[model samples]
Target: MDPRKQRSRDRLYAAALELAAEHPIADLTVTQLAGAAGVHRSTFYEHADSPQALVEAALTAELDVLREELLKDRADAATAVAKVTEAVLRHILIHVDLYRRELADGAGGLHAMLSRHFRGTTETLLERGRIDLDVTVEGMPPARVADAAARFLADGTVGIIDGWLRHPSARVEDFLRVYAALLPSWWPHSPAA
Candidate 1:
């Protein structure tokens, strides 16, 4: 939490974002990132072992700002989907370049890491809520419902964001409509997925 470390990370994140504008997550490397930030290669390695890690850190940095400023609202269970839709649309709109660089690359992108966190976040919410969640493991007992729901929500969000990233200027309503119509069948008890 040192201010110096924060500054270094900020510089690296900025550099990564800039380079992602031209290149992509898979194409960008730690050496290029360090050089872009004017930091030594060792410094970049001190923070992250690979370009994926660096990109993850950069994405986490950007998401913090978005979560605080844009996704601060918490709604009731019935309306939570709306809040999520708004927040996700804003996230995609605000960071489409980063999304494209990280998530649009299929499995090797940032979506894997970010979607795991998203699933975990949803699990926390379900644990603290009154909703009848149906999260379940592949072959385990019923204690894993929250984690399972988290994965569904996380991957669903990623897919939506991936589509939106391909069409950055589309209306939020359009995405929300498409998602609302398609997501229920993929939920826990939605007719065998």
Candidate 2:
């Protein structure tokens, strides 16, 4: 990763995102992306093979920021989860326009990237022991339990947030309150058995 090459790649990604915001990904062309990026078409080829790859790279760049932000604060499992959820929603709201198009169409590219990123982040949290899963399910090891919990949470939370993004009626704080209540401590019965 040479510095100049990295800058060119960044420019290509930025150009693709800008074009994507104005036109559908299906309609965008490599020449247009390269032109906007101020790079030659050959340069773009060095970075990404296709427009979809550019879209995924751009989206991953954005999501990576959210992940880094979540990793900043040290807290208990419940608190960390809450912070991660809040950060995720805030990031989405900030880029609602880009996400609206991606989430709406784009051949499920956005959904796939989001699911993978969110789930991987959740798995990282579990691996770091930042989020403790006290409850043990029968026949499942603690680590396996954590993995399953992370998967479920990642899927359910993303689904819920995606729905909210589509409708966007509730305040962020209101949604967060509901999300926090899903934590083990907020549950009526002890989560651990």
Candidate 3:
């Protein structure tokens, strides 16, 4: 990628995140994001086709950073999984405002997109032996179990998260408790239990 273009995209991503934090995703516009990033309206078009596309790019970039954070300082399989799951929940909590806005607006299947990204990251971890799993998917080959597990967990996780987002009383701890329930044997039970 060209350095200058990369810089512009990076600015746009950062600006999108900032605006997302402050305004509803549906209410945000390309002009607002471009102005926030100190770039021209045409420059944003050079990077993304629409405001939703820009937001998706920003969210994807944030998720990439979170993936790196979760994979750092590798540990046992259970510990690693616990860390990754917790990091995901915490990341969502930190961006709860944006999530609520997007979910309420029906902003283009964000949960599905997140699930896809998570599945890809988890599959990579499994293939690289970063996360060890003893279970196989149905009668499938052991080599492909990682792919299957990733799909199951990623889809399930996103579904649970979307439910929590819709619930008015759901908090970060509530979300974490639901996630932790999936891996009860991984760590000490939470206070909620």
Q: Candidate 3: minimum summed lDDT over ten consecutive residues — where?
A: 184-193
Question: How do all models score by TM-score?
Answer: 0.77, 0.80, 0.77
What value of lDDT does candidate 3 attain over all alpha carbons? Answer: 0.75
* Candidate 2 residue runs with Cα over 4 Å from true position: 105-107, 168-170, 181-193
Q: What is the lDDT ranking, best to worst?
A: 3, 2, 1
Q: How accurate is candidate 2 locally (lDDT)?
A: 0.72
- lDDT pick, better of 2 and 3: 3
Count of backbone clashes for each model? 1, 0, 0
Q: After superposition, how far is residue 168 of candidate 3 from its true place, in Å?
A: 4.0
Per-residue alpha-carbon lDDT of model 3 for 2-35, expressed as tens digits? 9999999999998988888787666889888999
Look at candidate 2 and tell me the lDDT of residue 60.
84
Candidate 1 lDDT, 1-193, residue by residue in tens:
7998888888888888778766767788878999999889988987888877887777776555544432344544445545554765676666667676567666765778778656755665565662456445677766565566667778987888677667747678887677777665424222211
Q: Pick the candidate with the highest TM-score.
A: 2
Winner on lDDT (1 vs 3):
3
Instruction: State the C-alpha lDDT per candidate.
Output: 0.68, 0.72, 0.75
